[model samples]
Target: MSAMQLDAPQVYDVIVVGGGNAALCAALSAHKAGATVVILEAASREERGGNSRFAGTAFRAPHQGLAHVKTVLCEQALEDAERCSMSPYTPEDYRNDLQSTSHGRNDPLMSEIMIQDAWETIEWMKDKGVRWETTLRKYYNIETQKGIIIDLMSGAPVKVVGDGEGLIRDLYNAVENASIPVRYDCPAHELLTSGDTVYGVRTRQTDKYVDFYGQVLLACGGFSANPAMRRQYLGEGWDLVPVRGTRHNTGTMLRRAVEAGARPVGHWGAAHASPQDIDAPLTGDITKTPVIPRYSYTYGISVNVEGKRFFDEGEAEFGLTYAKIGKMIGDQPRAIAYQIFDQKTIYLLQTRYSSGRPIVADTIRELATKLDVNPTVLERTVQEFNAACPGADIGHFDPHHLDGLCTSSSLAIPKSNWALRLERGPFVAYGVTCGITFTYGGIASDDKARVLNNEGKAMPGLYCAGEIAGGVFYHNYAGGAGLTKGAVFGRIAGREAALRAKGAGGEAARFRPCKMEAAISSRRTA
Candidate 1:
């Protein structure tokens, strides 16, 4: 028997699958571009806030000047990406980075499009009601001035705030004013495709299945919260790791896409480790203690299982640090490291660290005991660090005196007056666990944000943005770039998807599902 068809199809120009910044931008952009758009959000409108809303509202770029903005075009962005990328840079350097970071598994065409159009999208956002704060600096100065730095132009703001509620509120209000249909508590189960082209989406809502037809945008987010997908993509050990973002980002829609022949790209799970509560729930829990503030003037020095410091402690970018940390998991007992700090350090961190529980102890030994680490090792680590501070070098680990040393702890403070000792008792210790904010790896998309099939051709009526698009960066992520990429690319995808919908004709061939046995087996090795 033929499947029952709706006598009157509830048609739209496009259907957006997520409610985050990317999804919102895409839906709004498509609507403004003269397409009827509908947003199918898995959560209630009130609870629809995704990781974008909770982000540190900063937009990162290499060169900043209204005068030189044209010079810092797509080519310049691609070149800057190549300098820090892990893969051999290509003309499609951004796309290669996206795929290489995902271990050569993302859609290259989509990746290319997103990179190509990112700057224009940012400009469009500015044209629309988004305004960046003008007083921030765009660069970081390390000692000797030989380190990763983002060049900031004179009189230009380095970071921009989304007005948090204001940005989303405006988009939400605009979406409502447009009279776009939004189905809340409706979770898309799978894509209904007619061969190679997507036709619609099957959703599960209120214990009933509803089939909606239109071009679908899979913006449901990455699988950071799904334990099964986390284990499959990240690793088996990820079962113990806590998710630190929205719970609705379960990757359900992504699974459906993959099942329909959409190749996965950029699968590495990069995350932000919170020091407050170990393995805490993604939402809720604010602790009051002598712990360091969130995002304050703080630097990180990570130690391995051997209690030896590895990597530059001052590197503030969490994505870069997590890529390094992902290498050390299961290396030794505890498989953990303590973020060493004192009272002043606590105050500094209090300004930056957002949500996490903190542990307080009066001595290094006491702090070590509370964390179940070796007291002698911890003490020696502190002493050696302190002694090395005089020469601005911590044993083999060189200390670039960008920030002064820990002065409160005498055991760890350098002899130099410039160095601050970690002497004061009641030392604070926060358990640092590898927590993921979002997945960096995803399907590769072009500058236009079109999702390409395994053969590297754009799939008609299919588009993606946000964390779903891969190949923007390879190893390092400057703060605020992810959100910028998402918002920018989402607009690109929305506009292009609307164009495709308007021009589409005839039934496209259905996608044949790939053999997953091999992919699953390969995942085991990954």
Candidate 2:
């Protein structure tokens, strides 16, 4: 799949850097808009798709209940359609969630574009052969005639059929079907620019430098995997945290974009970090399997190394507070924390924790000793927490919504919701730490997905999408928004760049063999 092996073109209309979802979407869209496109992926073919491959397969979108959701669903999902029920996620609901999570710090224009285009983009991807399914059936109450009624707080109801890997596979198939060539292991190192306009990219191919001339789209992702950048941008001890995504997203292209005069935007100190297994590897599975995240902390109490409850584990739903909790744990001693659960709330844990190795004990003291924390402090902490709980009754404990079952207000850090007394025997504990998914800081871009200079003007011939285009998120994030944001902006960048390249037609445009019409006219290789 190397570009050098093929009869390479002298130049293309669009050259997309990165092989993730955004880059694939851009390439597919640009090819549809009648442009010759090529993709430059930093990873080899086997390890391609960047962080998007490791991402959870869900997407948060504005839908008019299950009727609208069925429009983008696969045939398999449609079979069980009658058993599902979802309240309509209106445009206002989407807007408010974004604002509330980012604390109103998200770029208004970018947020607006995402909200407006989210559903349409999902439909577009579905038309391009992507299949979707509603996940987390347990979050819905399945006893009623309506079958499973979704929880409003669980914003992301739909996920791609095969998760992240399935998403990238479908998109890559679309790209190949459209005759767009993707060159793996060809990492773009420098932007080939003419003054303020980017014209191409210089990539490192094997042992030599190869230049691919075209309208450039940068979607190479954030620098969470880079230790120097993490420590420098995210502050102390960040470099030691586990990476939840690809190790190839080292910010080479992001730094290059900034060096080429693109303005940096968003919260540099914040990121999409979240809690995962303490034993999880730094770069996920060797086969690039998605890491099993432990987001069931909302049903339990999390304690620091000192055996004291540090923060409210149920301050909000897991979607809104997981990133904040991850950062909080990362700031704790040794960047470690343990989530304690009892028999009462153990069944409420999500299936994502099925692979976790929880330390089990019949008593609080035994559990503390197994966790390596001071038994006296841990026992006291559990006792104090138990005294604060309302009662041991599990009837009022609803896992779907914020049932106001909270700990006593007099406690130093009161549990806001789902507070159950940990008095049951056979207690369980799962050790956790921060897993950095992606950074929130990168080169700036406009609503149209055009790269912006320091003066806020759109730079000609340059565009960005995916995690590389920041400002949509800040301190917190809603689950599934990343995939939507990428698709919406990737399509936008692809179309805008293609139009510009078509309008700026020169000798490259006259070279018709690489064009869409020529590929269709000849024996198609895709």
Query: Which prediction has the highest lDDT against the true structure?
Result: 2
lDDT of 2 by residue, 99-141 (tens): 9999999999999999999888988999999998776443332
Reference-based TM-score of each model: 0.71, 0.92
Candidate 1, 482-508: lDDT as tens digits? 666777777877888787777663331
Q: List the residue pairs that clash in candidate 2.
A: none
Q: Give the candidate number with the greatest TM-score.
A: 2
TM-score of predicted structure 1: 0.71
List the candidate 2 regions with Cα displacement exceeding 4 Å. 1-9, 79-83, 137-154, 286-291, 507-526
Candidate 2 residue-wise lDDT at 423: 85
lDDT, model 2: 0.83
